[model samples]
Target: MRLFNTNTARAGVAVIRAGSLDRSDELDVPVHAWVKRKQPWLVLPKDAEMFEDASTMEVLFKLFAR
Candidate 1:
């Protein structure tokens, strides 16, 4: 097994602080479906620009910034 070092852990914290990573499982299909069922009025943004594999830092920033 492997373990993370201080710098590695710090880097991860920095990324979270910068809002570059999505820690919530909100975008997960099952979770999304459940939330939608619970709150039918709630809506999620949809766009042709949606992608499966990659996204820009600005997108990630907007998504995780809260």
Candidate 2:
């Protein structure tokens, strides 16, 4: 999955379980590191609204709407 910070125009990719949205440290480290480095004010692995892979357009709409 892809995560984007609209405020900073920065984005990262991560692998999360579809059912639980759990992230794997080994796979997500790079994304975590980038977030820590570039957007330290933000906390990771926080509770967030989850969408299915098919809801990508909805995600994009919501993101841009904000």
Candidate 3:
């Protein structure tokens, strides 16, 4: 079971953020992937690397970037 915080719960009030839709177009596929690849550094807990970080958002961006 994935645990989420109050912010996460509040943020998901709808399928998307109420005013965030335009951000997607600002992302070039390359930049998007790069940002995603590096994102895990922000979200993963320091001691949570039990297995591959492959499924982490950071890895996804890295894969998408290349």
Candidate 4:
């Protein structure tokens, strides 16, 4: 999942993988609430490895800048 914190040219992106999370993961309640609120704007790709390459991430960043 890619969570974009902003929709403007200087948007910040965070990448989260399903495998990287577990039930025991300790995320703050407010932060989790924020993520839930931002869920609609998140990019959830079917293929988890799609953005594993640096080039792909760079391309996405450039696209966001535009």
Models, CA RMSD each:
11.2, 13.9, 13.7, 13.6
The clash count of every prediction, one per candidate, is: 0, 0, 1, 0
Q: How are the candidates ranked when ordered by TM-score, highest leading?
A: 1, 2, 3, 4
| 1-66: candidate 2 lDDT, tens digit per residue | 443223323244233443354553344321222232445575566444433223354454555576
Task: Identify the leading candidate in terms of lDDT.
Answer: 4
Give the residue spans of candidate 2 off by over 4 A: 1-43, 50-55
lDDT (tens digit, per residue) of candidate 4 on 27-50? 422112223334467764343333
Alpha carbon lDDT of each predicted model:
0.38, 0.40, 0.37, 0.41
lDDT of 4: 0.41
Once fitted onto the true fold, the runs of candidate 4 whose alpha carbons sit more than 4 angstroms away are 1-11, 22-52, 57-66
Candidate 1: pairs in clash: none
lDDT score of residue 58 within candidate 2: 45
| Model 2 global lDDT (CA atoms, 0 to 1) | 0.40
What are the models' TM-scores?
Answer: 0.26, 0.24, 0.20, 0.20
Q: Over the full model, what C-alpha lDDT does candidate 3 score relative to the true structure?
A: 0.37
Question: Which model is ahead, 3 or 4, in terms of TM-score?
Answer: 3
Q: Which candidate is the best by TM-score?
A: 1
Model 4, 25: alpha-carbon shift in Å? 17
Clashing pairs in 4: none
**Candidate 3 lDDT for residue 55:** 32
lDDT of 3 at 3: 29
